[model samples]
Target: MSNRAAYETVLPYVREWVSYKVWQLRVPGVQVAVGYEGEVLFDEAWGYADVEAGRRLTTTDLFRIASHSKTFTATALLQLAERGALRLDDTVGTYVPALVDGGSPIADATLRELMEMGAGVLRDGHDGDHWSLLRPFPDEQELLALVLDRGQKVPAGSAFNYSNLGYALLGLVIAAVSGKPYNEYVRESITEPLGLRNTGPDWEPARADEFVVGYTGFHAARHRRRIDHVDTRAMAAATGFHGTASDLVRYFSQHVIGQGTLLTDHSKRLAQRKAWSATDDPAGRGYGAGFIVDRIGDREVRGHSGGFPGHITQSVFDPESGLVVSVLTSAASGPASLIATAIVRLLDAAADADAPGTPIPDGVDPATFTGRFANPWGVTDVARIGARLVEVDPSAPDPLDTPTRLEVVDADTLRMTAGNRFGSIDEDVTYDRAADGTVRSIRGGGGMTSEPWSVPEEAPETAAGLR
Candidate 1:
């Protein structure tokens, strides 16, 4: 199937899944934007931008995308390289002379090493309490001083150690090489040319009202207190970008293979090349310049995840399918990455066009398959929507948790089809019937069994309403 066709097949479940997540995780707000076949297929926002003020989140609402700023910074550096202004292998001392004069180890590290987080620079410098919101982010003077004094934590060209400080130094490199401030250069060159009106190097005072109010303490507790936004100043190139979900996906579209409007094909490849293995990653992700490269099934995806004081965000792009997904959430601990990846899995399942078993015969009552069942893991509800029988997890924060489709193979046996973070699923489901012809329990190939469950009398009004 074509990319658009694949997307359309899964579109119906997107909103329901997102809503379930917002309700399940108690996320204050969320924004998601999806691009397919060179065009945006979905751009939506959910919940509130400001829960206390009763402000609803919109597609245009700006979020502090934080570490995603590194991608733009990396792009700008590549742009300079393309123009012969600099080379990736050039040592930091070649551009910024202060580190060399101060005898900092990073001064000997090449620009490529810094960009790939293999320079082994300290993740943050001494007195990095700024991240705790106790003090403001560093200015150029403070950042330079920190680098000059603390130096590298590990030897250059060592294991991957994600360093905001490394990107911050790149911001300085951009200024030193381009003779323009990092933010000014990025805005004039990248955002302007791309017509990304909703994106900027940092939060703009004029657009402050459009920004979502980030929150803290929401991950572990229901009560979340608002946190104030701060300027990153010199660190803008590292973790200081603010943008809407739509603009983020659009920016990533430029990086798709054969798109080539921004950087040359060679430059794009160099930036996306796996420079180092992120061995610490349980998912086996790799670091590629500014992007995190990983595989979902057989397709390779490149993107970045961002975390600020109160906002968490993730974006991934599959060049083969021309699909990009971005998820932004207001809470500091939101599952932005998980949600984005799950959506990609759904699209992949649609493109594969492989559902389990044949459809139920016509004239068979769909209600026969409809009921709520429970297992040790959670509850699963089978319901008929239109002409299809779908299994959903009413208790899951992700509505997409249930099987995509359930097809009857016999009176008491069925096959469940669904997509997960890794890929597609096709498994048999068997139902145990009581003497009265009622489903006593349901079991899947995985050995998990779900017994009949009814909405409890004391269940929350909201829970009952979902039935």
Candidate 2:
């Protein structure tokens, strides 16, 4: 099937998994949106925007999409380049001479170096406690001071050095070249033109009520505390965009190759091309001008992730398929990438189910066999993806990892068609139902029994008994 078809087929499972994960991880709040063929197919949110006040998160609530601001900054720079305002290869000192006159080596770095994260600058400056809200984010003067004092980590273009400090400098370059403040230039040039009403470069006091209250990650010793929204000031270009997952996915959809009004197709190509290998990533991901270029399954994707003091967010799009996924969370330790990747993987698996000869039998309803089940061992979720029913381990890091394909036999019986040797391959799986036809229990896989999940799971009893 086409990706659009596959996404439609598996959307229910994706939604189920997303909701389950939020409950399992105890995330304070989450907003997830998926864009397919330039339209948002799924948009939902879970948990409380303000847990203390009992305010639920909505799809419209604004999130501190930190570092995603880089994409906007990079796009702004490319727009200027397209208009002959400035060249990417121009030295930082060419526009903002303060860094050069201040005797900082950072003045010699090119705008391209900064955008590609090859400028070899500090990740954040000394006294980075501002991230924890101990102090304010750097103002222009303070950011310049940080750059002037030993900011260069290595020679420019020698290696991939991820640096918020570099992008902050890019903001200055933008301001000097455009003769407008960084935020104003981006608002008029990018967000406004795109018709994105909810997106902006920094926290706005006027829209404070629309913004969700970010929260600290769960602590074993204490409850999560709320994090106050603060202006990023000079560093806004690097880490201060506020937006919704809906707008985020839509914005990222514009970055997909061949489908954007924000930049020329050529500029989009330049911005999304792999510029540097990310040595810090074990997955061997690469960085583009302002995007993280990585693979999920076999599909290459370009996107950006953001981390504010108490919020973590991820947005990605498959250029070939025009599929986009964005996850926004309100806690420091939220697994935004993990959740986003799972959505992609599930869609991929659904796509594979559309291949020839793997179709479910005639008159069989895969959805009838789908539900969450619990046994003494753990939780198992039987889900319908595309035309296939597969046993999914919801607790697994990748839910589709080592899945057992279930084939329909009769109305209530399914046979395991494929799985590891330890499983009951080719064995009949029967479901027991209540009088009203709701699934009561399932008997399958190594002859183990599981019932529809209910009741809270309790901690295992030790030799000393449950604590």
Candidate 3:
């Protein structure tokens, strides 16, 4: 039972959402969990994780956390930090000697930089396309060799450009410093201590009956097998963990309540503190560490979002409410953050309705909210046609394409219409323009962190060298 049932009032709203008319025309299955003031307010699952198999996502249904797994990877590194095995400022080259490209000092890069996406590497896969093809796939050392020769064009610690390769390197570092396989270290360091039984890499096969089989290639025009592949051997630290909503409820409870076992309060602060940015997101908001921090209703909220080919996951922590809300979706089209916002609003409303109602705050000034601001994510070379719009020549949709579009939507919000190209309808998280009246930054709904900005300092050059 919650200290207060008022928070659970979000359930009806969520039920309405699950059964909404717009949803049917949209995505397929979704699983969501709400933890309020550190307690499980609602832990319910709806829709199907495996639609073809007719598997309904139960509150306990396990789904691939996708890149939400990075949150755990960050946690694992912090654990190593607490033990003094490595410092956040320690260079990558210092920890994982193999990451050095041709004796270059990748190790001199700080863990803090790598953890925060400031490390200037591309979002390349851990191994070559043939990574999964090799028998007894190459270990981290061999994986490093695959990209070691491919040196970076940008100097280390140049602005924030997220690279999956960086975390992959951190995974290797965690393994080296702990003297244990990354998976085993994570289990002992995080899952075991937190009592998160349902959480681990390989959601299925590990639990089989309890885990939802994630599907890939959703809505692909071409017919393709809906396959579930676990690159745990190669991607364990960066993208390997799995768990259920109930487990997360327990996980949230432990942390928000000062359980004090798994992570120290100081470490928790480091975990949540804002660090880096995506430079520019199709949305706004600056990136901070692994989390995206933004303002909502006179309060700052911290969170992150993740999507794999088949799964999309979102989790947010409301410091004001001591509430942590997480939603995991197995469908490619499912929108998890939308679900999270709806839940948050419902709870906030319920919180107010429970007590004597305070006057609703005056709406923010309509003036400060409008304008043309660009931070690299949407393409709106053409304006909206009537009520509906189309995306023409959006983001460097190709590997060589430079994504440079200043998305224009309603004031203080980003509502992008998905075309044949973009799969998700991203939300624009609005920020209060600095008193300076220039864009301090803006954040998008995808939870990709944006950062403090300088406009004439016009937008950061995301297209430079694209040619």
lDDT for every model?
A: 0.81, 0.85, 0.57
lDDT of 3 by residue, 298-366 (tens): 456776676655667777776445777788766455567666665565455445433321221245332
How do the residues 248-325 of candidate 1 rate in per-residue lDDT, one tens digit apiece? 989999998888488887877888878887886655789899998988767799989999998999999976557999
Report the error of model 3 at residue 259, Å.
5.1
Clashing pairs in 1: none
* TM-score for candidate 2, residues paired by index: 0.94
Task: Give the candidate number with the greatest lDDT.
Answer: 2
Give the total clashing residue pairs for model 2: 0
TM-score winner, 1 or 2: 2
Q: What is the lDDT of residue 168 in candidate 1?
A: 95
- On TM-score, the stronger of 2 and 3 is 2
RMSD for each of the candidates: 6.3, 3.8, 15.6
Best by TM-score: 2
